[model samples]
Target: DDTPYDTQFCNWTVQSRFPSNQVTLGPWVNPTFLVGDFGLLRESFKNQEWGFQNWTTRRLQLTYNGLSWRDTAQVQFSMRRKAYWYTINIVIPSQIMWVMCYSSLYIRPDASPARVSLVVLSILTLITLSNRAFDMLPIVSEPVWITDYLFILNILCCAHLAQFILLHSALRAQDRRKKRKQQQQQQD
Candidate 1:
């Protein structure tokens, strides 16, 4: 599936076989003039989760076999997925998870259980959110904007976890050194 902001161009053409001279078909400037149920068409597009944009209409005369000329009317438009829905459901939640994941850095490294649990939980929740986002979208060969965003978040989470691990190891080593120094002082 393409990103919410990604637009798709579409064209609809109506051609009449009547000779241009005998009967003039259309230069339908208004969609309502072209289709009696223009509102219905708009609602149907909305139902399909697309927002219509950049609409234009053109009239042309086409000749076939160099003998007959026909009247043609064309409607051109662009469509995009409704972005507000994605912003509310996927983007906001993912951002919150990212914030929570990074916030683990503030926790004292000595409290390994709390710090590790916070980071791990954030990672798990982010993964769940990413999966939910993908489930809402149709499968496509290429990655979309949401996919890239989630991937970046995943990388950041891993980095934070690695930092915590290193910090915890260093603290433990320092504590061991302090204990050894105390024992040497007592023996002396």
Candidate 2:
């Protein structure tokens, strides 16, 4: 699922009513033999999420179906989802959220509200993004690469929050020691 390119092959058989003994099927000699309108063909396969890939027609063949033999021709088409859409919608935004989470580390430890809020917001945004990405994909037993990327981002956000918690705790402890020393000095 993580692959950038997706290929799908469809076989369409045009079977002849006459048996191989009476008639035979052969590949089109002319490039534009049966193809009527090129524009219409392209438009029919056009998709928003998936771009149209190349299509090919296989050589004609004679096959037996118990009762009689027939001639058949196959046409296959391939298409792939546009990577730019995913990159724009999911990847870029998640990267921005990660940057925001990382930036919280540079904030002063005393500013607990700002630092905590930033990390928390980043975590929430990442969760929403992950959900959105997952919704776009079909459900499968195996994990997807986009989900894995988001999971890593969530972990990084958590690590940033943990760092902030530790810093805040140490700052509080230092303040408490200073207060205790001042109280003792005043009493003395």
TM-scores of the candidates in the order shown: 0.79, 0.80
Q: Pick the candidate with the highest lDDT.
A: 1
Encode model 2's per-residue lDDT on 1-188: one tens digit a residue. Answer: 66433455565556678764332234344544433212124334567777765666554547566776576556566677788877898899999999999999888888889999999999999999998987887777776788899999999999999988888899899999999999999999
Which ranges in model 2 have alpha carbons more than 4 Å from their true place? Answer: 3-6, 17-43
Q: Tell me the lDDT of model 2 at 122.
A: 96
Which candidate leads the pack in TM-score? 2
Show the lowest summed lDDT stretch of 10 residues, model 1. Answer: 35-44
TM-score of 2: 0.80
Global lDDT of each model? Answer: 0.76, 0.75
| Residue-level lDDT for 180 in candidate 1 | 100
Off by more than 4 A, model 1: 17-45, 138-143
